[model samples]
Target chain A: MTDSKDTGEAGEVKKDHGVLYIGMDFGTSRTSVSASNGVRETVYSTVGYPKDIVSMKLLKKDVLFGKDAIERRLSLKLYRPLEKGVIKMGDDADAESKANLKAARDLIGEAIRIAKPRADELVYCVIGAPAKASIHNREAIIEAAREHVDSVMLCSEPFAVAYGLDWLEDVLVVDIGAGTTDLCRMHGTMPEETDQLMFDTAGDAVDAELAKQIQDTCPGAQFTVQMIKDIKERYGFVGEAAERVVVDLPVDGKPTPFDLTDQLKTACTVLIEPILEGLRRLIATFDPEFQAKLKGRVLLAGGGSMVKGLDTAVEKAMNERLGGGKVIRIEEPVYGGSNGALKIAHDMPEDFWEQLK
Target chain B: MAGFKETLKDAVRQMSFRTSLDKLKKKGVQNVNVLGVDRIIALIEAAVHRSLKSRMVGIDRDAVAESTKAEFLRLLRSNEDLQREKSQIEQARERAEEEIDLMRRELGEKRSLLRVKLEQDAMELVTRYSGENQAIAMKVAEICRSFAESGDASVSSVEERLMELVMDVVSGEREEAEVARKALQDREVGNLQRRIKKLNDTLVTTEQRLQQASTMKQFDRGISSIYREVQGLDGSDSHAGKKRELMVDLFKANLKLQKRGKGA
Candidate 1:
């Protein structure tokens, strides 16, 4: 289907459009659909609804996408497709599952559409999926892209992060995402299925634990998964001793200060063992030639990498196990996945798709 | 105590009869109705006429009294019989009323259930039936648009043809939609097309890989194995059909009518 839709319009960007590399760090908790179009920013992967068909019709749109979707969630159905890092089929009932996939597709589609490429633009994308996204999930994403753009490739999120840093050596890339913390070992080549490891415990788990702790301490405090996440992002840290910590809690429908130092530390520490275990396994997998190098060069990526004292905790645990190693944390959470995707789009020749197994 | 009171009453009535008979003997009265206009006169007349006449003209006075008394006693003996007959009439009336009430209740209940069931079914059918209807409608619309753009026919004929198409689609759509809606409301088909789609898409690559592995062997089996493997590409194509069927079922189950009041 072709249409003689005019170009050179006000809404259209008058740019070269070539060398315009687009990378989509499509994640479960939050998705940052960025392009080398101009600037980089991460938007939460969420969609919201309107009060009813009338409200949507009045607004002249069926649904709100991204941050707008979240802001107006009180009126609309809130959908997050990449639950646990992949689309889950609504078991026995599929309306919900279909809706999720459709919502995600629309969100991604909107982002790409907004980038506004020229007619002759070569639109290449390296969309991120969960490291352990079942084959079906990846295909669903690919199929969704059929109408969106020209060339699209699905890559693992952790691999994307690893690719962003160009750490193609014996580096253990641990991506602590919203739904799960994926650990992948890079041996200077495209990591195979054996090299990747996925576990369903990450930022979401900490938030859940923190919410439970808050509920237990303060009886009537209003809290939800999102609220707890906001709190965790603000005050999440891991350490032993600190000054007297006091945070507001709803005491009989009012905010009152109750020390949450012990609980916060506890919640932050919950993810320590899994990270350590992941590192140990990755280090052990190294064929004697790269074992020593792999020990010291452990890269922690994703938004969860920003947690205070996490590096120290991981380093300490590794020290206890391997006796010595260097643990480095990537600073740029926003462009990690995008940068990796862009690199893949650039490095892999156009004809390389023919060589895929 | 109640029985004793009844027996005493009977004895008093018998004594009065005896007194009346004596008074009748003293008087010249023969019948009750022919007696003079006095309380004793009425009683004496009744005893002489009713008791003595029947005795002299017929058989023994005691026997006549006993036999007449026996017949009268026999008539009053069955209290339950009167009650039973009255009860039978009442019971018949009650049964007729109850049957009418039950029939009315059943008719209303059945209508209520049918309406709910049909409405639910209709909604389900509308989604699928109307979905197909909508699909066909869209196709017709597309054809109309193409024809309009092409200038194949005059303006009036185009409009007329389009209207006819719309009418035909609506009627046919309604019938199928109703059937589909009923199927859905009746929960005959489980709408699961979307779910199957998600499953198929997500696992497409994995399934392909599995098939690839199954085909390839360690020793490189002959051309037969390769041909068999190539032929048995049990992946997206097979799942696509299943998904469509599931979708059709789902649409039927959750379809609601877009146009109208009741049946429409």
Candidate 2:
């Protein structure tokens, strides 16, 4: 074990011999990295390359990570990791995935450097992986984290969300991240393998569905999944009849009015049934004594939770079938998972981690 | 004094006798040289007075006459025979000179014809390069226009169009080279076939003069392809993917000389 330190670049340097605890939430859509000894920041998980070798040399860098990377995409090669919460190995998504995974590692390493731990410091990092991460993907993340941290452990994303929310007893946690929606039923202890369910259809899938619908309804509408996501984030509403969506779509080299009311509504409704099923199945797992209490405390933690009228839609669906339940949406998006990992890191004794490792 | 006087008188008589012998030797030498002889008295008497000189001469008449007469008869026979031989040699020399002149004319005609053909070929090559470049520039520009107007700007589109362009250039150049080369080759093959036919006809006629034990070497396709490709010609007409597949097949067929694929 080594002591934590901050040698004048920023922050106070600790003189104690205690080890630093770093909490990392390595999400498919975004990564939230934090250190318990006061090193934390959230960065968008994206990497970009300059237009040409000349531009790359001029910038003195080949790739850029995070929000700035997305903004300079016309002159860059943009990369996104964990498409639908799993590493894509097929020809369609292989190249983007490999680059994204590499970028994620680079980002984590950079964040660790900012912490500035002492030479003797044994950095213990807890990284949050997807709830349904395959054995191979889990190993890959561990290998990636091991490059920077002395010791690293990978925990499920929804478990981290539930831990961060502090609803550990008889609570059903439904985390809808950009990749996949995960449901974990915690009964005051470590979740059993049978206690969790994962669905591949999530926020990003909905965005793709919306884009496809828009293209089919309005021919010659130039739109990518990212653009669809932007629109969804801004005006995605369920269980309501809104005015006709009139947006400018580039058609034959000119901007044209594309009325996408039916398309938008149909697209947003794609994930409703799956989410309702996931919640119904998870809540049914609670023993008879706590079933009613657990039903009302169904927590939703992720970017997808921000979809308008999601709680209401879920509440309405549950009310009609499974009696009554409340959909609780988490306010904090950036550090939801990392905060949970930090809590674990702070509470657990160093000796307890030694046994787990 | 007496010895000196006697020596002077002997010298004067020897000089007169030597002068008379020289005149006779000179006259005798002419006929004997022709007759192929050495003895002077026998030669003189035989040449100037054959019958009378042979009988009156102190030297053996029969021996001299027998030899001289035999030589004269041989010379007379040779002169008659040489007239016929000289006529034959003159006729042969004249025919050989005529044939040599005809050969020189034929060689000149071949050299001039080859020079003219080379000049024409050089001009054709220059024209072909200019035409191909112009065609390529125009076609590439047109394809690029379609690309710019395309809705999808994916790298795949550019890759596909570029592949098409490459295929067109490669295949077109291939076809042109093949057609040109084939035309030349077919004409050459036809001419060679005709020459072979003529030689075969001559062979049939002159079979008795020829050795029946010898045979000509067979034509090799492998060696032919090497020569064709060197002149920018390919055997197969397949383009793009098909061309690659055929080349793969060819490579597999010639595996002993090639780096074999993993499966092979």
Candidate 3:
């Protein structure tokens, strides 16, 4: 048999090896990965550790992930380690920050593990980060990913979406993610800082607005942020109402159905003005010759884009506000960034990969 | 190139089976044509190159040859990794089997020892109780004899008194012996029962561990990737150049960030 050293460390021997390219979209609400091996998976960005010895024994696992973590959160020291589309390491360096960093690292490792890379292949990864992520936040992400991959790189999230769709020039992408909405304009080149815009008026904000509306209108209704977010994901829409969203909430430990159709519609409508504002800023600031092209090819992507009739609503808003425009939602909103990053990883020259290693 | 050839030879040898001359002769005629190892290796290389040249065009022959060699070496390395993992798992399974066997043997020995001790204690209790009963009977007979020999009352009255005394003494002695025997038996049996229970618990725990180890061994087959070799971007892709440029930009940014992190 060939010696065990054949699969040894990267530089130990000059054995010809295959490269496993992985593209990751790490978001506040979910982390998705697309690998060259054709594995695509998305996980909720939640990590949990058993609280004590008894819990650890009962769980039979040191850590729980995603939905399992959420379900068993009471028995766990749960951490949702990302906020506003970046690692939530608070300004001060403290125990909580360190714990969050660890959770982020673990979450990244779990994302890679789910890709199921072969041990004999070299692993190179590309991660799509928030456009406005600080250097420290980017560095933290790199450090976390480096533990699981041989080499890693980062790109802007909305730009990755645009790139994945092969729209290199005069295409505007609005990625409505859980924590933030990122608007990036592509114009035949890598976008500069001025080409992108970010704001927090996205999925989480809609959940908060919906929760507030419920509290104001539906007396004695009890719910959590997670429950409200789930409700929005299931029945959220703008423009014409498809159907009434009548959901049951516990009222004094009794199941009570509340008519939240108007509330949900109002909460979801909050995204339009801010998104149009972002669009106006990007389209108005672009070169006058390409403004029409940018407006006509506006692509809606991300989890928040999954809201029903959002594209038509955005199109309607664009007609009244900025002459006229077309809004097109991507075929796969959740996998857009990761798919683009995978394309980048594939097209990356071998020398660049080798140098990074 | 020499190392690659040697690795290929090793892989070939590993895949081939060994047999004795007697078995070979039984299967076929004995005479064999032997070739030098170097000659065999040269022939294989020439055959691969000729095959590639027949099917390929536009790409340089040398580049094709190099890539073929690289692909061959990569497959060989992957095979080697799988082999190593298989060997490790096999060893683990064997170790778990041995541990389970030892535990079973120990459990059997402990059970047999407990049974023997319990049987010996029962025998000793039976022997001691019979001996005490015989002594009590003799004492009762002696009191009756003394009462008959002494002249105190009428014969019939003396006989009735003797009988009553004998009955009372024997009845009291029998109750005392029964209680003592029961207490002794309960203490010894309780101690032995506790030991047997402890051994049974240990046996169950060891069996569970063995079961876990076996399950792990069964699950040791590593996950397989969809692509067997490196897959670069398809040449027909329209944005290959643009994507390449983006890749370069991304690399430069990450390099700077990583460098800064290291500096800090």
Best by TM-score: 3
Model 3 DockQ vs. reference:
0.18
Off by over 4 Å in 3: A1-17, B1-215, B218-235
Error of 2 at B11 (Å): 99
Clash count for each candidate, listed in order shown: 23, 2, 0
lDDT per residue as tens, model 2, A250-289: 8887999887767777777877799889878777766878
- State the weakest 10-residue window (summed lDDT) of model 1 chain A: A1-10
Docking class of 1: incorrect
- For B1-264, candidate 1 gives per-residue lDDT tens digits of 334334334533433534475688679766666322244434643774586775587556765545444433433333334446556556555555555455555556555666676677568656766677667868787877888798888878778877877787789868866875675543322323343444455445445544544444222311111011111112354333432332233222212211111123
lDDT for residue B211 in candidate 1, whole number 0-100 = 50
Q: How close is candidate 2 to the true structure, as a TM-score?
A: 0.51
User: lDDT tens string, model 1, A121-183?
Assistant: 546566777788875676667656634555567778887788667676778888888888999
* Model 1, residue A245: C-alpha shift (Å): 4.8
Error of model 1, residue B261, in angstroms: 44
Judging by TM-score, tell me the better candidate of 1 and 3: 3
Highest lDDT: give the candidate number: 3
lDDT of 2 by residue, B96-170 (tens): 555545555555655565567667878988998999899999988988888778766689888998899999899
Q: Name the candidate, 2 or 3, with the larger TM-score value.
A: 3
User: Candidate 1: how large is its RMSD?
Assistant: 40.7
